[model samples]
Every structure is written in structure tokens, then in C-alpha cells.
Target: MNHNIIFQKIETVDLADVAAIEQQCYPNPWPIKTMQDCLDADYQCLKGLTELSPEIRCYAFMMIGHEEAHLLKITVHPAHRKKGLAQAMLHRLTLIARINHARKIWLEVRTSNDEAIRFYRRAGFEIKGKRRNYYRYKDHNGKQIKEDALVMCYSLI
Candidate 1:
């Protein structure tokens, strides 16, 4: 982890950079409209940028409600993997949630995504439940395939 890396609120100015990272990180990345919706929504969104380049390296979208928050998404650029950017983002989200009076944080990840599961577990998130057929995607044959999702939660209490 580079302790000196800079993290900033996801402002409108950083959309293009954020979208680029999002596309690089996910198989089915959110569209520009979805990113815009997240920015316009009542959630707290953030971006992690390198100190030298000041380009978006990672981003997180979280919706805060009364004493709880749902971590909608967190993505790190493929080039920035294994550098603790995700951990830093999660840590920052915990702090932000605590400051916003959130007692717990929750999120869902694809069950087949072992790397992400390990990452969340290392960050203190525990498996809470499973969401069946949570991810639906069309295959090369144009048939929809359903994938399971693991629901994880972390207590900020």
C-alpha cells in the first residue's frame, strides 16, 4: 500500500477517468448513464488517484441511509491491482460511513469472483447470505446465464 496515494471525492470532473477505470475493471461495466446516475444519486461516491498523475485509479459507490450503508460498487483499474488500492478504498469507505452515522456496511459480489471474496474477507467483511441468480448475462450463444451473488456485510459498530 502506498500510504501517500491521494483519494478524492468523485466529482463531475472525474467522470471520464472513473469510467475508464470502470471499464477496465469489470466484465460488464456500468454505462455512462449509470455512472452519471450514481453521481446524481444520494450516495457518496469517491475516487482514488495517484499522487503524481492525479488520474483516477479506483472508484467506489456507496449509498448511506439511517445507520447503514450499501456499498454498490468498487473497482480498481486493472493496472493498479494488488497495490492495496481496493483496501484503501474500503478503509476510506468505512471511515466515511462512520462519520455519516452508519453502523454497518453491506455489499454483494459475484460468487465466482474468488479474488474479490478474498479481498473483502481480508478487509473484515463476512458472508451474510447468498443471492441466487443475482447476475444475469448473455453468453456467446445469446442465451442468458444466471450467476450467484454472495452477500457480505461488515459491522462498523
Candidate 2:
């Protein structure tokens, strides 16, 4: 984690910046509305900013249920890749989950996203199962595609 990075609870005013990073990080990004809905539902949403600057460089969303927490989304800006920003946000999320009494933290990653899988593993998450056709998106050619999601978990207990 970078010493200069700070994690802040995401607010409505931060959506545009987080959305921009989302658009840049994934093939299909969540709309600002979806993020708003998560907040409205009392999910934990956060944005990462540089201590010296207010720019949002990364963001994450997590939903906590009885004895578990699910990481709905976590993203780092492309330009900030390899700088430990993602890990910083992830660590913060893990702490929040633990504080909330989650026995484990779960996340689904696209099977093809080896980079993300590796990162999760390094952060103590284990591959638990596969969710078939969990993600549906249109490719660049406008053809709908379904991708399997690798369910991963990090146990706190």
C-alpha cells in the first residue's frame, strides 16, 4: 500500500470520479445509479484519494450479511496500476468486514482476470468455487457474452 493513499467513505459527490475509474478498469462498469443504490442499502462503499490531492484513484463496494461479507466491486485506475492502491482498498474492506463480525469475505472475479485472481490470492483469499455465467456483458462487437465468475473467500475466523 502506498503511504500517500487514503481511504474515505464514498459519498454521492464522489460517484462521478469513481465511475470514471470504473469505466476505465473493466469491460462493464457499474453505473452511478447502481453505486447509489448500494449506498442507499447501507453497503460499505469507499474511494481512495491521494493524501496530497483530492483525485479519486480507486474505489470499492462491499455488502455484509450475517457472518459474511461480499466484495461487490473493487477497482484501481489504470494509470495507478501496480502501485498497491488496489491492495490498500482491499485491506480496508477486509478490516471493515471483520469489524462487522464477518466470518469470511467473499468476492467473485472473472475467470479470465488472472491479474485480479493473483492479487486476491496474495491478499489471503482462496478460490472457493465457480459461478457459471455470473457476468453477462456485450463485447466490443456488440455480441452478448457470458463469463464464469470464480468465487473466492477470505476467512477471518
Could you say which candidate leads in TM-score?
2
> Against the true structure, whose lDDT is highest?
2
List, residue by residue over 47-123, the lDDT tens digit for candidate 1.
88876888777889999999999999988888888999899888888999999999999999999888999999999
Give lDDT: candidate 2, residue 47: 87
Instruction: List the RMSD of every prediction in angstroms.
Output: 1.6, 1.0
How many clashes in candidate 1?
0
lDDT of 2 at 144: 96
lDDT of 1: 0.86
Residue pair clashes in candidate 2 = none
Off by over 4 Å in 1: 139-143
Residue-pair clashes per prediction, in order, are 0, 0
Q: What would the TM-score be for candidate 1 when compared with the true structure?
A: 0.92
33-113 per-residue lDDT for model 2 (tens digits)? 999999899899998887678988888899999999999988888888899998888888888998999999999999999
